[model samples]
Target: MADLVFTVFTSLDSYIEKPGGVFAPPPWSDEVGEAWSNAALARAQHLIYGRVNFEFNKGFWSAAETDPNSIAAGIDYAPKMNALPKTVMSRTLTGDPGWNGRIAGPDIAAEVARLKRDVTGGDIFAFSGAGAAETLFGADLVDEFWLMITPQLFGDGKPLFREGRPESTMRLVECRPLDVGSVILRYRRASEG
Candidate 1:
């Protein structure tokens, strides 16, 4: 079975986005981007997202794949990202999701659980989908977490985890610091360790 990995880029204080709904810019040096791309390519076989993030990523990365002027175009990231299969978890979103994507059925947890059972050997990544992450985390379906934390802190913003979440233990698997002062932390469910 595949591991369901909840991955996010956050500020030092664990905010996934700044106060104005804007994301904190990723600390991307060429070396950092390369390493990130390599790791992404090595592990992820499927991608999951919330409606908002799904649309944003589709627009951004689709353009980045062909637009030489795009910041991410120079890196190997864009094409790989665009090529992956994506599932968008949204009840309100109708019709085609575009960009090699599909709308997940009403039951978020069930869909993810099905993916976990079917997709063998690789990881199913929940990328920047706060709601989806929370749902999967709550369902006890999340097997790993990959958090990339930038050096700066957002005093207040959207947090990765909210109040009243179930308690669970994690074992640190890797901690790598980037040249840009960002750190990538990987954790697996403690039972798996």
Candidate 2:
């Protein structure tokens, strides 16, 4: 079974992007990127995302494929993710003809649960989809969360997490600091209603 994890780069103000909903500059360092990529490749078998992030990354990473080493390992892994299977949690998107996966419905907990038992032993990652994140959180399907927090802040910015009735309680499992003043925090989902 593959675990369901998430990769999000948030600002100190708890925003994942700027006022325009565009993600902030690439704040990942080689070490940070490598660690994330290694962790990604180690446990995640699929890339799940929102339409916005999916499109933005589709263009950003496609242009950097030639020089894999020139980009962060996460970006370097783009091609792999491009070629890998993905599942987007979108309602407005109508087309993804060349995409590696499909858009799923709201009731994804069943599908996610089934994916968890596929015997691949990788992770099913939610790649910056606040809506999907919220949905999964509401469903109590996520096992762990991997949050990459940067030092900067945007007083008015896109939300870093899906807002809902917060889980009864989430337990912190670990925290790692990066050289670029960013920190990665991991949390395990505790008992929920």
Candidate 3:
């Protein structure tokens, strides 16, 4: 069975996004970009996203296709990222996402389950922060988590785990320190769970 993984970049305080819609940019550097490209994006065969993130990524990345070296693309692997198939989970989105993407139905867990079975990709990845990740985690659908912890912290911001999700235990696969004091943590749900 294809495994569902949540790969996200978060602050030391566990915030995914800044509070109040203010952009709290991660400490992104060339080294960090290359590391992400080589480590996560390169291995991914397919990607899944929450509705808002899907739309945002499509617009942002699609426009930078012609200029792979542009700041917006931010990596040498733009083409690969653009080509990967994506499924966007949305209840309100009715049509195609213009890019090589699909709109998943309202039942997020069931749809993800179907994808896990049917996807020929080596692994299915979701970078949905807390929105879809919470739902998937709650349903026990996520098999692994790949979190890149930035060195900085935001005292109050959008958290990676929300208020009411059930607790889950994970087994650490490895923790690697990257450039500029960032760390990438790989963990899988305990087998006995």
Candidate 4:
């Protein structure tokens, strides 16, 4: 079965977004993190996202591909991101979600489980959406977590690990520091370890 890897980019305090719903790259974000992300994306057979993140990413990356002046236009992973098949978990979004994507059914957990059982060769990567991640976490469907933790703190914001998730031990698979002072941590469910 394909492993479901939830990848998150957060502040040291674990907040994924700043207050007021601002979504910006961490101050310490650099090429090292980008390279690491590219490698992970390269290994993903399918990309998954929550509705908000999916829409934001599609708008940015799709525009980048066509806009030569776009900051992300030259990024190595831009094309791969656009080309990869994506499943957006959403109940309100209808029709095509663009950029080689589809809207998932109402049952999010079941759809994710089906992907884990059917997809082969590479793993499924969840790039964003804490709510979706929490749902997957609660259902015991997430196999791994790849977190990029920056040094700064948001004080208060949208946390990646929210309340009500089932308590489970995580095995530290890898830890590496980037030149920009950000740290990359990989963890697997201890039960699987």
Clashing pairs in 3: none
- Once superposed on the true structure, which residue ranges of model 3 sit more than 4 Å away at CA? 66-69, 72-74
Best by TM-score: 4
lDDT (C-alpha) at residue 17 in model 1: 82
Best model per lDDT: 4
For candidate 1, the 10 contiguous residues with the lowest summed lDDT are 32-41
Better of 1 and 2 by TM-score: 1
The lDDT per prediction is: 0.83, 0.72, 0.79, 0.84
Sorting all predicted structures by lDDT, with the top scorer first, yields: 4, 1, 3, 2
Task: Give one digit per residue, the lDDT tens place, for model 3 in 1-193.
Answer: 6788788888899988888745455676677777665677756778999888887778777866776666657656767768888998777788777778998877878888888888774778896856777787777787888888989888888888877666787899878788788988989977733
RMSD, model 4, all Cα superposed? 1.7
| Higher-scoring candidate on TM-score, 2 or 4 | 4
lDDT of 1 by residue, 33-148 (tens): 66665786679889998888998888888987678898668656678788888889887889888998999998877898888888766889887566766776777777888888
Better of 1 and 2 by lDDT: 1
TM-score leaderboard ranking:
4, 1, 3, 2
List, residue by residue over 1-193, the lDDT tens digit for candidate 4: 8999998889998898889778858554456646477669877999999889898889888977789888679776788888888998887889997889999898878899899898898999987677777777777778898888888889988888877778888999999888888888999988885
- Comparing 2 with 4 on lDDT, the higher-scoring candidate is 4
Q: Looking at candidate 4, what is the lDDT of residue 121?
A: 89
For candidate 3, the clash count comes to: 0
